[model samples]
Target: MDSIPNQQHAWVNLRRGEPAEALEYRADWPVSKNLEPGEALVKVHAAALNPAGYKLMKFLPNFVANRPLGDQVFGWVRSDHMRLTNQGALCQYAKVREDWIAYAPSNIPLDEVAGFAIVGITAHDMTVKNADLQAGQRIFVNGGSTSVGAIAIQIAKSRGVHVTASASAKNEAFVRRQGADEFVDYTTVSLPEFLWQRAEEGRKFDYIFEMAGVTDPSMYTQSDSYLSPMGFYATVGPQPKGLYLSEIWNLMKTTLFWHLPRVLGGPKAPFKLVCLDYQREDLEQLQRYISEGAVKPIVDSTYNFKDTLQAYERLMNGKIAGKVIVKVNIEDN
Candidate 1:
């Protein structure tokens, strides 16, 4: 392996406003000869493709003059900020900050570790940080089969919370394996109606993790009925324009009808909005979970480094049940 020439391969965007046709397959971009201080030179074994990758590239023309032109090949969240990097894991080797990298679990295959950090951190933030979930609480997860959803389920379960999750009928079993106590098929079931019925039955959740924002504000408005008094709602998906308008209206309604009672009359209501951010400590905790077999990597598929476009396409198609990883290279170490 030492005798193998040091070479790096990457999928680069050379032109603007083009689809996958704009990507340039290259054998060389840049490679670090040695690790800098607080850095580790890793032989990238795998990389997970997030849906944001395709959305960013497709919308690049709106943000930048050159369209899909940027050195940063991948975007990952670090704390509250989004970090862009040309040095994606879709190469033979990558130099990363040692602080940014978590020790991969020994039990999981090396390829699966690539997809762990981003989603793992997101899940940890939503369940532990934003929701402030306590043991024995009941929570609702809006999307059970997504990469982030899978991690959220495990994290919530580990904290001893009971999780009710929504997914397609086909993915119900898969989500159940991840630890969902109840399953709701969004295809056939009316979520808002179902939640209202549950509320009528004296059922409610302490927290709601909204991962599927496909129905705009309707999902939130409807799910609000299922929340217990003083519950929290954390969202990771983008809300539609109309939904944003609806949210403003709802806020106004709350301020007019509910706020006065809480402030002047000393009445209490249950509703809060939360947006999640990634943290290094979350990654470390998730790594421990993965290592201990409490959580497992759910990889939808693996593609070679050159097939990153295909991986991105797979993510955009909404067919993947879990994370999609790209194999950069195999390493003995």
Candidate 2:
């Protein structure tokens, strides 16, 4: 183990706004070295950016109305439940819950491994936990080129499930490369209409996983046309583009879809928001998948320590096909 430093660099959000406006890079942020039982300090080699992190940064001003707060480049410290109170992975070192950590697959590059946990865990929950899909079942993955979608496709395929997924035509090949059995070019057609056509052809899917955080409810509302009677629909959650009335309207409709009872003519399939719950076994399963090449970590781009802001900008642009990684310990790059 390397000698721990007293102070480390971190990207702090002093106020709420876009990444560039809200974040300030500090070289002398204090390092919290206090370790409770089951906590371990990680000398972070790299950290991956998730849209949730920034979305929270933009929306949540403070946890206690004024209390300020603050990955892995991989050793463990404390559970993710402590995340809000502890320092974030955007710094040089992170303390994570011991049970939440797992060994990185030796076959994966260190930079890519930094991103595996979050997406991997979410994919596991979506495909394995929530759906419990069996061999020969069929699944539809929205945003097939996105990180979670890609991993979900691979995980589904590993279970012998057929995967039909959607992406823009430009990412069709990328989506297919992640083991999708069939592809839908969402940009070229109305997604609901296309699925309805498949339904007409008796190609109903047993599971539908939404990774794009779509605000539109039409797909869920009309899912009876294509989803199996016993099928399930899960999502990361709806993400409104902005606070505009249009966005608000979309959310209201989505909320209704979620809460509406089947007796009220809601979609036939059940719905759920697939959130990642940390489990040591799930992390170990992901490590095994990576070790066996059943799943591959997809890194869309890498940014150096000083260029952390640029990394956030790339992530916020929302055009990338995989996880956006920041190399926290520059020497690791």
The candidate that wins on lDDT is 2
Model 1 spans with C-alpha error above 4 angstroms: 1-6, 17-19, 34-36, 58-85, 222-224, 239-276, 330-333
**Model 1 per-residue lDDT tens digits across residues 181-233:** 99999899887787777778887878778776443445455454677877856
Q: Give the TM-score of candidate 2.
A: 0.90
* Residue 230 Cα positional deviation in candidate 1, in Å, after optimal superposition: 1.8
Itemize residue pairs with steric clashes in candidate 2. 39-77, 40-77, 45-73, 77-96, 78-96, 78-97, 79-97
lDDT of each: 0.65, 0.78
lDDT of model number 1:
0.65
Q: Estimate the TM-score for candidate 1.
A: 0.79
Backbone clashes per model, in order? 2, 7
